[model samples]
Target: MPFFVPVGRRLSAALGLCLALLCLPAFAIDAAPADADPAPIALDARRATISLDGRSQQLLDPTGALGIDDIAAGPPGLNWRLRGAGERTVLSGQTALWLRFDVLMRDTQAHWELELARSGTDAITMYYRDAQGQWRVQRAGDRLAVSDWANPDRYPVFSLDVRPDETVRYWVRVEHARVPFSGVFQLHDHNTLREQRIHQQFVLGAYFGMALLLTVVALANMAVFRDAAFATYAIYISLLGLSMAASLGVGGQFLWPNLVRWNQEAEFVLLPLMGLVGLMFVRQVAQPRRIGRTLDRLCLALAAAWLIGIVWDQSLPSALSLQALSALGTLSMLTIAAMLGLAWRSGETWIRWFAVSMVPVLLASTLPVLRNFNLLSSNFLSQYGIVIAASIEAPLLFYALLMRSRIQHETQARAHALERTEPLTGLTHRPHFLLRLHDSLVRAQRYGHHSALLLVHLHNHAEIAARHGREVADRALVIAASQLRAVARDVDTAARLDDDSFALLIEGPVKPDQVLHTATSLLANGLRLSPRLPAGTTLRLRVVAALLPDADSELAQDAAAHLEWMRQGMLTLSEEPRKAILRLNF
Candidate 1:
């Protein structure tokens, strides 16, 4: 949020790219090798695309009308079709796309690995004849359980061995439900494949780690501040991380390899919940008063609707459910944007900060929506865009949250400070002073620190009020408080215990003689009044000192016992002349 202009420019460029991608149409690609009569194209360990065209690939019906013999024999006049013109193609419905390609090996000693880069495909099966001339099939995809895959890798991979100059035909069958399906194929040898896996893991692991850090920080803020906004944000970020893990295949590979059903259902469940919690966070940061009742109610209603939708989505048809969830996500985005706009117009600086923080996610979510409805092809950005965006957005939002939490903490501290203060004396009140004294005593007994307590009683306060007025007596008390504060050390806490009584908690290594000297000085200074008093007006003060135990001794448990003893000692000496200071050592 702090460098908004630069971030806005970057986001504009990214959003422009997303729009350009959305505007382009999916293309049909030709990745098939040359015919048998033509020269063979040798392939090494480098990655290469296996393109498919109307002539190279054919769509087969779900009824299995065309058998493997017909597909293998390369029969003429086959009903093959192309979805578009390029390497990428988007297909819908229940038919399997069979891609046939020839792999000519240049190095027979090296093994070639085939990888399907695109995820979200329902099922993929590759068919190739073995050395015994028997057709063997290798299966992989989200449609099947994780345990069913040939290898426990993140993507669908297959290994192939071929002799040099030998051309072999391979058939890959791909199928999906509801969503547009396209398989981006690549061939990598052992070393190349290993590097690819390592690179992919690094990218995903970094993103996941960033999300985890943000989640912990948000949860901590919630604990300290007791605010629902932080809690909602924590939930939203956690779902975002989980959704990425599921989409990027990290969840299936590591988190729940055996829970195949959860792997399949994670994205569906997490996306809606992210929307719900995200909207709740928005409503919390932008106070209801700022957004007004109508719009606020609308936000709450939308949140409830999403909650119901999450339940209904699981039960409804997959195609309908996907469409509904996509719609819900898009709607939530627009509504939150509008709410932020309203708050910004109303001059909410924190709202602007949040809006700035959301730029990456807003831009990243666009292509995924377009791809979901078959308007765009699945590519690098569309597949991992949200995850990448979250790596940046989470930290920025965390900064914004830190700012908000700091403001809240500072405000609460101010209110608490005021509540603990006495308005008349500008000092700690009786209740809060008792708490301070208790804490000090606890620390003194635990740490062996010397401590002293001083109690001052204005003996002439009532007499002064009867002679002059209550206002004059109040002025005399104020003057006495000033004198006590002037004599008290910086480490001591001076508090008003009652109308005419003041107490001091002196944390000390001071001797009992020093405490008695300070008490004598306070009683001598109490006669100093603010205004020039009438000719014969006078004031009297009785001050008492009690030295507490330096360690956890018997007197530590009865710290309050000395207060009554000091007061009784002062009362007993009230009749004696010039007995202004009383000392009770414990």
Candidate 2:
């Protein structure tokens, strides 16, 4: 001011002052500062196990071009973000992902293992340094046969050794290009890891055992009853059990350990197959056509779609196939629900209970579908939900099948009764009587025993019907049937041979005299007055008896010809004045 500065100079002085003030904080900061490293995870006496979800750092390789050396170099461009707040690590659309973490051990010596808890990853490689300062690598995942993995197990496992106060660095690379990747990583000591694996296997064993038991029961029922529903149920459960095994990695680890391609493709194929068989089972049990023709056709179409989906899945990409199958599964569940609902509304009351039984399995099945679509993360429920629910569903479904079988048996028994018995007399009809007679005569011939056939003709049947109404004549026939049943032994067969004729087959071990006595009893009983008949009415009978298995006459060995011979004897006796009993020994 005292030097009389110009206006522009004054403004420039102010700007210089402002620039120095902004530069003061930058001058205070140190250049070449050390990189920020997160604190190492401690595995001490109190912390024997830990999950790496929130503690580990992850780097995504979009093109999967990075190698172990590039990851190990910690390039400035590689940004690793902490895997925070979630139990599962999920990365979509990336060809590979790298996980890095450091573990600090305070124990004297510790044997630890790192487990990637998901089973279906394409490939996984672990990079670390041994105590000898030499780089080491371990390989595991579905691309390689389970038998060839660094550790052959249901899940990929890597071993680690740390001394007291030693800090070890680890790098894990995951390659999952076919589908979205989701995994859980956990660090555990040797004993804890072993115990957990044993528990898991034990639980899986229980589930598979239950599935086997159910399948056996279904097959047994199918064999005994010859029900298509039971057979279909057995197939459905078997496929379902195998599908779950593949999904849980048990198939890869134990069933087809050396079949790397099949192990990867098994779940994709088995799920559709299981669904198809399940739909067929529903059709057998529900018989949806009973509800509506449209509903039935829809169910058939859905099942056919599942069959086609099996073929479609094989030709499509893995991710696309999974998505398609998930959609199909969801549609199948809905279709089943609709079919059951329509059936229930149409008065299939028993189907209500079946629908109730289906709820748990349908819900459980949806969990895996959700997982396949990446809508749900992998967990115990997602992994084993179907098995647990199937344990409940299997028993209930068996009960439903039993109910259905019983109903069918009862209906068939009623139909058979109607077909074999005379409706008016409630006695064996002509066809069934002939069948029994043929059997009895064959047995008598085989054992050289005596069997007798007694034939009675109601001589006054026409006269009585003419006098009274047909109703009174029916009462007389009923009386005759009751008398026949009362005189016949339990082992003997009482049958109505024709409109006015009745017959009693005395089974083997009978003397001729006994046959004569039986004929006499029948004549005497028919002669008695029945209160149910019209007043002053007596049943006059012409009785004929033939001992079966005549050695000389072939007619005696044949049921029809033997009965005709007895009828001829009755016709000959018709000419007699008196109602008489005729016994013929051939």
Candidate 3:
């Protein structure tokens, strides 16, 4: 193995290690004890926030046959236990769990709002006594439509009117088909609740606005540059925005209030689409050619599988789709990390910047999955991390795209410039030079300014090319062009007329004597090199100079006629072989 392979591979290894460590937070969630419980939350303030995880009493019935009423009635032999202390409570298995807590408010003027900060719950029914001693019931969860929600908030909000010095008992019956991850339950006054909602809306708007801006920028890049990668990136960003909006409940409440089913299934739809387009965008930007064909094909296959899951979502169970989503999300993150590492190893420097840009979003994308698997506690960071990360990562990704685009544009421009240039001499080619010469002649004729043309022919270029190969021949031509440029003025046009011929057009009223002097100087320079030329290889210079006559002179009236006269003089000089320079004195 070589000592210095590509830096990309080494970076890839480092990135893998870093990402593995990143997954630790997710794994830490599983380490939380099933029986772990936090101490009871004391109602110490008129407005306060608390987690109901282990602070409340919990009774789990695996059969899900026990209701809140049954639990409150005190089953003679039924088991009733206090919930264990933990950062988050995970009620595993298909069961009904009843949680009970008592709240004592000291301020009579304080109107309480109890909010369950968790989302995606299958069903949650609350039992509480109001101020009039009437038992009231409130139903809220994924099972109910957003429009039918009691408070019209994304999460369930229960208004409480507890009298001063009065202790009220609350029971919540929770049922889920899969493992349920509990969140922090908060109790606060109207002002606190309003402030929180305002904060949430601000975050959501920033997140969605950033995503929208990125999408628009990507689309504009796609349209202007005709890059397919930008189009895919645009789609990816759009899906991310949709996912954020739907998950935050803003999309349901505002964007599509009538589309209840769409709101419920928004995550399922947007994530898969984001995954698919995200893979495509990664492949394109990372330069699959350098990352290896096998890896590229694998990314495509995974993207295709995610697409299939999205298409078949209607026929499959929601749980199956959700499970598939978590699996694919983890897989996608791993795959991206691997590909980025491989890209770095392959010597793709741009991928390094991209890797840096993806860090926040990668962490954001993983936290929710970990929370879903009960590997991380559910909170604002886990639930809304994508939006938070997107707000930061969007601009960074856009910068990466811009950098990549600029590099591509420069590369294309260089290639286009080379097409009109002679590679050996670094000067315009014969056709391009001729067009310039004709244009110069036309301008001089129209503007009534005198111009001088100096043509030099290297008669031995063929012998040198054949004897020493093209590399040596190319060096000799470059040397000759350099000599021509050194003596030419800044406004003068210097070009390669053919394989061994060169020309210079001086844009001024130069005398015939001046043209003769310029031609003589080039002859004396002798187009010769020192170190690398073959011992006997030498170049013979044939020079021709002409001063264009006026429209009334013996020569033809047009610029074409002046060019013909110079060409004829060069041909005549070629036939002589003995002539070194021909000066046409008009």
Please report the candidate that would top lDDT against the real structure. 2
lDDT of 2 at 415: 78
Which candidate number would show the highest TM-score if scored against the true structure?
3
TM-score computed on alpha carbons, candidate 3 = 0.77
The TM-score values for the models, in the order shown, are 0.72, 0.76, 0.77
Please provide, for model 1 over 338-449, each residue's C-alpha lDDT reduced to its tens digit, 9 standing for 90 to 100: 6665666655566567777887787677766676676666667778888777777776777777787788888888778778877676678877777777777777768776
- Which pairs clash in the backbone of model 3? 8-344, 8-345, 9-345, 12-341, 29-375, 36-84, 36-85, 37-84, 37-85, 38-85
Q: Which tens-of-lDDT digit does each residue in 251-271 have in candidate 2?
A: 999999999899878877887
> Which residue segments of model 2 deviate by more than 4 Å?
1-38, 45-48, 85-94, 107-110, 216-224, 303-312, 346-350, 409-427, 438-449, 454-491, 499-501, 511-586
Model 3, stretches more than 4 Å misplaced? Answer: 1-47, 61-80, 84-95, 145-147, 175-179, 287-293, 388-396, 439-473, 479-494, 504-564, 567-586
Output the lDDT of residue 472, model 2.
Answer: 87
In model 1, state the lDDT of residue 501. 84
Q: How far is candidate 3 from the true structure (C-alpha RMSD, Å)?
A: 5.3
Model 3 agreement with the true structure over 1-586: per-residue lDDT tens digits:
8887554455445545654665565545432223433343445453356555546776667777776567778778665556543345445556777777777767556567778786666667888878876778888766677677667677778776556677778888876554345666667776778888899888677777777877888999988877777888888889888877776667766777666667667766776677677777777777665636887788888888887777777467455566676788777776776666666655445666776677667667776566556566666776777777777777778877777777888888778888887777778776676666677766766777777888788877788888889888887777778778887889787888777788888876667777788888787776454566677665578888876544455653454456667678789898987788987665
The local distance difference test score of each candidate is 0.72, 0.79, 0.71
lDDT of 2 at 105: 77
